[model samples]
Target chain A: MSAPKALRQPASLRLVSAAFLAFWCLIAAFPIFWIAVMSIKVPIDAFAANPLDVILGPLTKAQGDGLSLLGIVAWIGFLWLTFRVCTRLLPALVSRHAPFGSAALGWLIAALAAGVLFVLLGFGVLVPLVRALDGALGLEPLIGLTTQHYQAVWVENAFWRNFVNSMIVTGGVVTVSLTVGTLAGYGLARSGSNLAFWILIVALVFRALPHSVLVAGYLPVFINSAEILRPILGDAAPTLYGQPLAVIAVLVAINQPFTIWMLRSFFQNIPADLDEAARVDGCTHFQAFRWVIMPVMWPGVITTGLFSFLLAYNDFLVTSLLLDASNQTMVPAIASYFNRETTTTDQVEAVAAAVSITAPLFLLVMVFQRQIVSGLTAGAVKG
Target chain B: MKFKTFAAFVAPSMFMMFLFIAAPLVSVFLQSFYLTQPVRVATEIETCTPGFTGQVCKTETKFLPQLDENGKVITETTFVGLESYRNVVQPDHAWAAISSFDWRGLMNIDFWKALRFTLTFTLLTLPLVIGVGLALALAVNNAARSIRGPVIFISLLPFIITPVIGALSIRWLFVGDGILTRLMEAYSGQDIAMFAQAWTIELLMLFYRVWHVAPFAFVIFYAGLQTVNTDSLEAAVIDGATRFERLRYVIVPHLMPLIVFVALIHLMDAYRVFEEVVGFRSQAHVISLQWLTYDFLEPDDAGNRSISRASASAMLTMIGIVILLVPLLRKTWRDHKGAH
Candidate 1:
């Protein structure tokens, strides 16, 4: 492929692109960043230090040192200007290839930006860490950073139970959906009948069906099932309504279509000759799938499993409707923090719970970023 | 393959799908035609009261659930035949309100209100999500290689987060005394209560929807961008086409099918918006058809649920989705046939 002339073009375009990317990066990162920051601050401190006020308020009257609010605001403004300059102007200057220019100036600007970032990080994160450590060490704490909210959410509010419930539900749904869906997808891929085509089409339509429609149908069935089972199981009958299994079943049902769609394509990519070769060795079809196919299908299975876990873990509508209070998953459990009956004092704890729920997913994205990107675009974009 | 082998392979999935998906669909349709209510009977009670002359006997009438021989209350499910649909759409009431020029009355109907919001929300956000997603893809496409991976991972964060949590996060930013809200107040010098009004809440919900889902579109467009033929791009570039022109002529056309794909997914998903309403707790101001169905299913103080109404609403929501999906499905069918 020849390099497009635009790639060798003016530095201005690259500068603009850099700045534009930086702006979007900030937009994407700020909310989570702000949430993380606010999660550590005391409730009063969190609400008091408004961004606008911090940027524009008057300064003075310090206890430790007489630093004016103006000083802090000015420092922040200077950092902001420096960041903008480094991202926008310095790129153009460096890319122009002037004498003693590109490499040295680029390094200089990077160092400057790094310095500013360190300062911002110190104020935003490190200070809080130090304060928490100070409190733990039985010393005078200069800032408010306590894990009491995390404790309150985990212990007093019983979010630990909800977290465990979410794990069980997600685990069950992912396992069941992948196991059943892979088999179905393999069958469809290998079949010569037109029924397979129609089934795929039908599954697509089912995937498009609103979750509420299905949940509405399940409502009566589950209720009746519980009623009928009461005579046999007595106290255990609540499992139908108030258990992870019911939620897991519905989740798997809803998730199967996408799982099958993804896996069908994955199976299609493998050479059919390999399976035939296995069969020639006196291996049964299931045995071929088990030994020959499954080994090569690991990557696809992992991708599908990730999505299945996401579906079960992230779902709100079905989980909230199907599972009773004692068995609610993390999404619905965190939402319960906002219920009208809960006191306003629990707001900080609610934020903490939100952070708790998001932490694992953030880690997942970090660890499996490559697979996730590929998995997301796999079905939508085709050659 | 033998039929028996195929059956053995496919039976589990088919059974689950049939039981859960097909059966419920049929039940929802059937339920739309029936009205399930408590069986009621009129009973008379004679009472003796001292009046001016002597004890006067009076009879009082009361309606109560009729009981069976075993003393269990029986629920009567009568096949009302489209009555539930009529009750929801309220054709007569709508016409009356329209003729009377009662604008408020027209909006007062829960179905119309929900329909209005649903249509507006779905239609309005479609182009924005597409546009923003395309822009991000373009920008990230041109970004330096070292930064590209991290940018994508960051962009995907919003899409990957749980939908409910994503909405809550944004809501927290703009709710009472939230960081963004406080910032706005401090900047504008006025208290801006974001969730207090209908339009504000709707706007926030729309914004949140875009923020949460645009990453999905970005990932799709970015993938589509990779497959754009480089020879065509080089030819366009050699022809002295500006970046915009190249994108307009060469790039977008290549990505057209993917744009349609994303649109189909978005329209189907957005038309049945429920999670946002639940997450934002905006049902009082902006209820959707999906929420309406859930609302109907919620048990009343007497521990009785309006299952018939919920089923009706569910059926209606499905019809709306089917209507939205017809064009896409037809196109897919045509393409399938063409391939054949």
Candidate 2:
């Protein structure tokens, strides 16, 4: 780790670099931190004229919605436990089971189990226990805190429906794109033909297309889909315009090019010897891919799947344009919350919804930070 | 692999791409030239109302769209042949404004206005993202090893957050009596509204984009740093190279291809900036090419949409991306050829 004589930085340069990095870390993370604070307070406190007032939340405390000292300790403990479970326990459990002997499936089961356990403990156990402790101790409110906005957003406004829709679209996209992309990528990686190169290039171009343009292309056809399908389905044909299925199809198409390109690079990294060894046993190509290459390909497949999940989950244009109001995904749903006229309470709820949308992404990054970073750098490095 | 096997393996993905991406592109290209409008017939209708104690009757002509047997509006499509493009660009007005050197006049046009913002936003953020990202990478490289993991984790949060949500969070921080604005107003002792004017909103958009994208650059450059040849650094030091000189010559040259890679990706993503416009609600003062197309395609209450114009705008946007990408793509092509 020793630096070369000329490569060594001066003390002042090191100091400045440290300061700059700290500043950047602040700039990068402050907004999320700030908004999470804003989401839990009364409107007056959230939008206070003085920044300290927003943080201290005096008005919110006066409104009888403050957190007691005990409550704060309990909540902090709960959060720390959750973090420990996600980063420590979950990984250990996942590795122990290796459920189905597949890394992807093991992680999936662990993540689901963690989520369900989190809900049950946080709502079913912690809240009631905290209230009981407060009553027993006769403690007064200390600092302001409220879950009313979150309650309004998730329950009254039924943001859970949007959450469900987002899951369906994202799940469909990840499953289909990965299933299709892995095969094509493996095929292209194995083939050294000019046609394979050309197909890869075309896919790169397709990857750069703005989603809006694609949405524009799909709109008219979607609007006329019933008529187009009538000849085959005999009068029961359904319009695809407003269905989540339509969005899943379009997102899969939009995601495929990148998926193929990434997975192709990953497949290329594996030596040709292993697959050749498998083929020497007189196995079919698909059989070799399934039985030999795939077990080794799990890491790459998981990385690529994380990206496809992000793209489909975070999408606004395709989901917003293709799906109608009732079927709206979370991103577009949050946008619609802003599109309407807003009362202050409604605006706070919007902030709550915005904060809620970020929770799953935060968890994903926490668990898969290494894979995500590698996924990003993988494409650039090879290029 | 055999040809049949390759084809079989790639068939599903190729079919999806053909049906969705390639076909839609063709459809968009053709759609830009054709305009579809509901067929409206002018009919005289008698309206009777009680007015001032007596029934008053008046005959008025109204245009109503004709519907067919299935309760669907009858429509006709006609080839307009560049009319939609002309409508979008407004060449006559653009030319007049350009000839007179009237930048304001040009900015008043929706297409020109959007193009101006989109280009400025894209081009301006490119260097900033690279610079900031490189600096962050260098900083982390120079820091104590124990802290890099936490620093990298915190830095990645911004990039992974949903783009609209990211923009919305920033907006809430500064929109109306938000914390940042309140602090600014307090320090400056002047009333300040970030969203009330074009310049501030534009600045925020630029800042937000750089903030959102710099981590991507950092991760790539950091990975690049791992592969930097220490032998070259030792040779440079023996040759009496200064710290900056080593970075300027040995380090940057090694990272040139990566710089181009980041720039290319940034150009493609930034050209279609739409989330900021929605999240900031800056349509009154700021709009982007993607937003303009969306506005055109959104159906009005009368069930009317300017599909041709939307298609033309979308096509123009795609062309812009291609044009911006040409230099980078050519470099990539050269590298590919050289490698082979």
Candidate 1 stretches with Cα past 4 Å from truth are A1-6, A52-142, A226-239, A341-343, B44-60, B67-72, B100-102
lDDT per residue as tens, model 1, A265-334: 8888888998899999999888888788877776678788888988899998888888878788889887
Please report the TM-score between candidate 1 and the true structure.
0.85
lDDT of 2 by residue, A66-88 (tens): 77899889989998898888877
Q: lDDT per model, in order?
A: 0.78, 0.90
Clashing pairs in 1: A59-A68, A59-A69, A60-A68, A60-A69
**C-alpha RMSD values across all candidates:** 9.5, 1.8
Give the docking tier of candidate 2.
high
Task: Supply candidate 1's per-residue lDDT for A304.
Answer: 84
Report the TM-score for the A-chain of model 1: 0.74
